[model samples]
Target: MLRESPYPMVSVSEATALIMAHVQPLRSEEIDALTALGRVLASDVVSPEDIPDVPKSAMDGYALRAADGLAPRRIVGELTAGGTATVAIAPGEATRIMTGAPMPIGADAMIPVELTEERDGMLYIQRELKPGDYVHSVGQDVRRGQMVLAAGTALGAAEIGLLATLGITRIAAYRQPRVAVLATGDEVVEPGSERPGGAVRDSNRYALMAAIREAGCIPISLGIARDDIDVQRQAILQGLDQADVLITSGGVSMGTRDLIKPLLAELGTVHFGRIAFKPGKPTTFATIGDKLVFGLPGYPVSSLVSFEVFVRPALRALQGDATPFRPQIEVTLAEPVRPSPDRPEYQRIIVRYQEGRLLAVTTGSQSSSRLLSLRGANGLLLVPAGETTYPAGSTLPALLTGQLLL
Candidate 1:
């Protein structure tokens, strides 16, 4: 039922380049560091003071000069964690120190309590000790006035811990974007609604909403629009008023009921009608003033694939993320596969480890409408159009989407 379009198809690379040319990073804002998880930093964070400003004991042990090893020494005093040991340790003298306690002055070494015996105010070493053993030197982990985190770094648990260590209560971060989602076609009914004859459930609406949330954007559902032209135009205009980007599903194809393309022509400039790619060939990108619009296919699998390939990057760009593309690695194919003759294919694949090598297994049936093709898939094999068939053990670059085998 595919119908030809009047516009010429563009390569995926060319389309990506054109799309990026219009991207401008959103403005920056300041927020509390505790609630800034997954947000991109707007400026570099510098350490105000060196971590562990003084030499500290890495374990509970006796602190003394290494030359006094294996010799009966007088226990001068006991130092616990969080207490300063300003008393100096002379030859044949030792101080009982707890973990994280500052090392006593003039102490060159530490012997763990297990390797020492104490009785009647005297401490005895079980074996010889080396200087600097079990002792953390000053500024060992971090130096003062050093760049702890760079701009555009995504804040995570580790990043938050680093900020806490530096006593930074607030940080400059980019604002999250609001994305509008609209579903098309009268045959698409809401879930739990009465199913009329030949009507299918509207899965794309909720699915795209979850995908938008996963990309760190707030999703605004514009409700379902029938195949009518006026209804579609009104919905598109309303979506533009509330969202930084508009995403519509099921109305960009060449079918007679596909009103999204014609409506966009009257509202704004359509960058391209179709892309030279599989499963998402009918994908459309356009702009109306400062807002961006994307028209994705109606099929479940096609809709998800289009979001991963295009919408995810756009969301990241809005958050001022420098590198937005998914990480790709070369993996060996476990079975034979053929590439598309006219366009490149993004075949769903499961990446596994065998003999210390990463191998890709096809998820079977790359049909755009078959949602099962994406089940348990962690990678997408990018099979180019130049290759006719790739035999077993052939290497190809694949986009990683799920947990890594490592």
Candidate 2:
């Protein structure tokens, strides 16, 4: 059983409930068959009829009745995948059928043509065929009215092929979540645009955009949001109007210029003010009607870290993905790390395999501003608050950050 957090800081479980309460299901859209890969099925798909629609051949050998397996069979007609054979096989007669060809009536098994020699209108069987040998029974792949896919199963190539077996040419899939991303704060600037003095290149927007796309959603860039309330309000509304999720960076901190929290409160109800996670403690999540809004910290590291912890899950839920977050594994600590009593820490650390064991080692610093350290790291050392003085070789839960895919 999971333990309830004792810290007044809203525990991860509580924070998750607060985050999910604001998001609503996205509308559905019909995408082309080829484009359905990685998309989620909006509803359960049941096979209208038996898959294969008929008993078909799984091999190229021969087709015959399973009861005729007792003696040598007669090959009177041949059938391929696209062609149909009208001549019915008698009690001891076998029809030649290639792979994917539907079996004729009274035929129970398929016999390979290579096993029989044919002369004139008669086929001579060289070996005795077994019962139910080559006949792919009707409904072997899928039965009529059988549930082929659950509502939440995201579509993939294999899934598409399975659906095709049921003659499904078109599918109903969950609409992609329209995520709006904005990099706010006067100090922030776009990556490609000309940079003015004192403006830092906007990495959060690009990183967040990539992350959103990886989650199979549509992401829009609202550029940079200035410190003005009206400007912030307009920007927030633009995201609220279209997107199911609105994500912004650089305005939830304690600085006098920070205006996201107050403006969001005025525009809509703020879901949660902050979380216990480090480097992202100032994060804020709110709802503008049905739109879920996340105000992330200005630092690139904090934005990425918090996204993994919060926004990623929200978007995944919107997409109907079964496994929303990155899979976690237990590893031994390569070095000891300290956590503050006030906040839980997600420290970027490198994990290396040594002597067939996973060992995690953190960089010299875990400050939010250190971009190089975070880039060099491959995993996170998750230490809860007030749990300081961990000795080397201790076991802890770590999130893999390198060489991983959703």
Q: Give the alpha carbon lDDT tens digit for every residue of 99-161 in model 2.
A: 998877777777676777766655666666666677677788788999989887888889988
Instruction: Mark the 10 consecutive residues where model 1 has the least summed lDDT.
Output: 78-87
Root-mean-square deviation of candidate 2: 5.3
Residue-level error in angstroms, candidate 2, position 189: 1.8
**Highest-TM-score candidate:** 1
Summarize candidate 1's per-residue lDDT along 1-406 as a digit string, tens digits.
6656976898888778777877887888989998788989888998888888888888998889998768898999989896754678999999999998888888988889998899999998888888888898877888899999888888989999989988998999888888999999989999989989999899898989998887778999998999999999999999999999999999888778999988887899888878998879989888888888999999999899888887788888888887878899999999998898888989999998778889999999999989899989998899998656999999999989888764
Task: Evaluate model 1: give its lDDT.
Answer: 0.88
For all predicted structures, in order, the TM-scores are 0.94, 0.82
Query: Candidate 2 — worst ten consecutive residues by lDDT sum?
Result: 2-11
Tell how far residue 159 is off in model 2, in angstroms. Answer: 2.3
Model 1 vs. true fold: TM: 0.94
Indicate the residue-level lDDT of 332 in model 2. Answer: 84
Candidate 2 yields a Cα-based lDDT of 0.79
